[model samples]
Target: QRDRFQTLAEYYRIKHGSIGPLRSWMDRHWTVSRDKIETSELHRLIVALNFPVIYTTNYDRNLEVAFEIHGVEYVKVANARDVSKARRDVPYIVKFHGDFDDDSSLVLTETDYLDRLSFDSPLDVRFRSDALGSTVLFIGYSLSDLNIRLLLHRLWQTWSRSGYEADRPPSFIFMAHRDPVEEAVLARWGITVVTGDDDDPEKGLLGFLSRLAALVEANPSDPPTLESGGELP
Candidate 1:
C-alpha cells in the first residue's frame, strides 16, 4: 500500500515520513545553476506586461530572474519574515508556496498545506487579501494541479460568502486548449478562461501577451501597492 501512493506529498510521506527529503528534492530540482537566469519569452512577456503584483505557486526563482534580467526592481515575499521586510517602491513577486532557496519556508506535504490553511499564515492572509482586491491572472498552471484547484475553490467560496459577488474583480486563466466542463466550472468561480489557438498555441500566447502589453502601455496607471507599503528595498 505504501508503494501505491499517487501524489508527490504522499510518495515522500511514505518514503521518509518527513519533509526533509522532499525539501532536498525540491531544492535540487528547482534551483537554477546560473546567478543570472536566461529569460524565456513567457517570462519576458510577464515583465513587459508590468503587472503590479505577481503570485506564483512555483518554488523556482525563474520569475525573479526574469525581473532581474529586465532591470525590474521587485520585492519577493515568501514567508512572514520576508513579508515584514518587503518593500513598496518596487513591484511584488508573491511566492505563495515558498521558495527553493529556503527549505524551512517550503510547503510540500499535505500536512504542510493543512498547517498553512489552519494557521492563516502570513502568506495565506496576503494571498486572500490580494485576490479580493486585484484582478488575478493565473498563468503557467493547469486544472491537473489539485492544489491550485483547491486554492481557487477556497477563493471562490470566500467571495461568494462576502455578499458582493457582483462586485468581485474579474480573474483569468490562460491555457493551451479549452475544456467545456472545466470552462463552465471556472466560470462559476468568476474566472474567465483564455485559450490559445488549437494549431498554433505558442503563437496564440505570444499574440495575447503582446496585445496585453500594448494595452497596458497605452493606458498607463500606477501599479498596485501593498496595503502596508514601504520604500523600495
Candidate 2:
C-alpha cells in the first residue's frame, strides 16, 4: 500500500532518483512470483468493462503485457502529459509507479517516497481530477501501504472540505481475498469491500463483471444510479 510505495519511493529518490538498482535487489532477496494471474485478470476485466485503469505498483510491465495479450489497445502514462492524451484514447492504463522500462520513473526508496509527498509536479492536478471522476477499484493492494492510503484519504477529505457534497465521494472498490482487517478502514473512508475466494478470484471477478455488464446492458436507457445516492447521475 502507501507505506510500501513510500518506502520504495523514498529509496529511489536517494539511490539515484530511480529504482534501477532495486530490481536487482529484489531478485537477490525476495521470493515472489513474477507471474500474477490477477494481473491478467486485470486486463480481462478492463476490456470487459471498457474502463480505464490506473495502477500503482513497483513491479514490471506485466499489466501492459496483459493488455496486449487481450488485443486491447492501451497507452502508458509516463508523465503528466500522457494523462490528457490517454484520456482521449480507446483505453488507458496509467502507471502511478514508474515502469520497468523507465528507470527514472520508478518511485522506490524512502527518499523518493518523501519527495513525492510534496507531489508538486504537473501531474498532480490530472491525478486529482481523474481520481475524483472515476470509480477506482483497488486489487492486489495491501492496506499497509500507509503512504498510498494517506494520499487517497487526503484526496477524499480535500474533495469534501472544498464544499462539495459531503456524501458524494468518489467510488472505490477493494477486491478482497478474505475480508482483511483493512476492509473496515477502507469502508470508513467509503471504499466498498468485495470478498471472494482468494484462490478463485479470477473466476469470481469474471462472474461479477459479467453480471455488471449485463446490468448495464439491460439498463442502457436509465443511466445507472446507486440507491445509496453518492455519485451524481
Candidate 3:
C-alpha cells in the first residue's frame, strides 16, 4: 500500500512530521538572495512605477532584490520589528506572508493560513491601515486564496460602512486574461479590472506593467499614485 498526500501541508507534515523541518528546508534552500535573483522584466517595470508601499503574499525576497538591483532603497517589513524601521520617504517592501530569515513569521501550511483569517496580526493590521488611504494596485494575484478575497471584501465593507464608499480612492487589479465572473465581482467590490492585449497571462501582465512604467517615467513630476499589492505565484 502507498500513501498519497493531497496537499502540500499534508506532504510536509507526513514527511518531516512537523512544521520545523519544513521551515528548516526553506531556510536552507528557498531564501533567494539579491545576487541569486535572475533578471526579470516584470519586476523592473513594477519598481519603475515607484509605488510607495508594496505588499506581497510571497515568502521569498525576490522583490527586495529587484529594488536593490535598480538602486532603489526599500525598507523590508517582514515582522513587527521590521515595521519600526519603515519610513515614509523610501519605498516599503512588505512580506505579508512571511520571510526567509524568520521562521516564526512564515505563513505556510494550512494552519498558518487559517490563523491569519482573524486579521489581528500586526502585519494584517498594518495592511488594513495602509490600504485604507492608498490607491492599491494588485498585480498577478490569484483569487484562489480565501484570505485575499476576505481581505478585499472587508476593505470594501469598511469603506461602505463609513458612508464614503463613493469617495474611496479607486483600486485596480491587472489580469492577463479577462474573466466575466471575476471582473463583475471585483467591480462590485470597488476594484476596477484592467486587462491587456496579450492572451498569454505572463505576457499580458508584462505588457500592462510596461505601459504603467512608461506613464510614470514620462510624468516624473506627477507620477501615478499607485502602490504595491502583488502576489507573484
Model 2, span 109-211: residue lDDT tens: 6665667777565455667776676666666666666666876687767676877736454465546364556666766676766655346866766655655
Over the stretch 1-233, how does candidate 1's per-residue lDDT look in tens digits? 21132356756777876667676776687677544356367778888887778888788888888888889999998889988898988889988888877767777666666676553889888888889988887887868766678778888999899899888887888777767898889888877787765457777787667667766676678433212111111
Model 1: lDDT equals: 0.75
How does residue 113 of candidate 1 score in lDDT? 66
**Candidate 3, position 39, lDDT:** 71
Q: CA lDDT of each candidate?
A: 0.75, 0.60, 0.78
Q: What is the C-alpha RMSD of each candidate to the true structure, in Å?
A: 7.0, 5.1, 5.0
Please list the residue runs of candidate 3 whose C-alpha ends up more than 4 Å from where it truly belongs after superposition: 1-7, 10-18, 27-38, 224-233
Single out the weakest 10-residue window by summed lDDT for candidate 1: 224-233
User: On residues 1-233, what C-alpha lDDT tens digit does candidate 3 reach at each position?
Assistant: 01121157656876877667776776668666555454778778778888889999777778888888998998999999888767879998899988877878887766777788899999999998888887888876777657788998999999989988888888888877778899888888988777766878889888777777776777788755443332221
Off by over 4 Å in 2: 1-21, 24-42, 84-87, 167-169, 175-184, 197-207, 213-233
- How many residue pairs clash in all the candidates, one count each? 0, 23, 0
TM-score of model 2 relative to the true fold? 0.70
Worst lDDT 10-window in candidate 3: 224-233
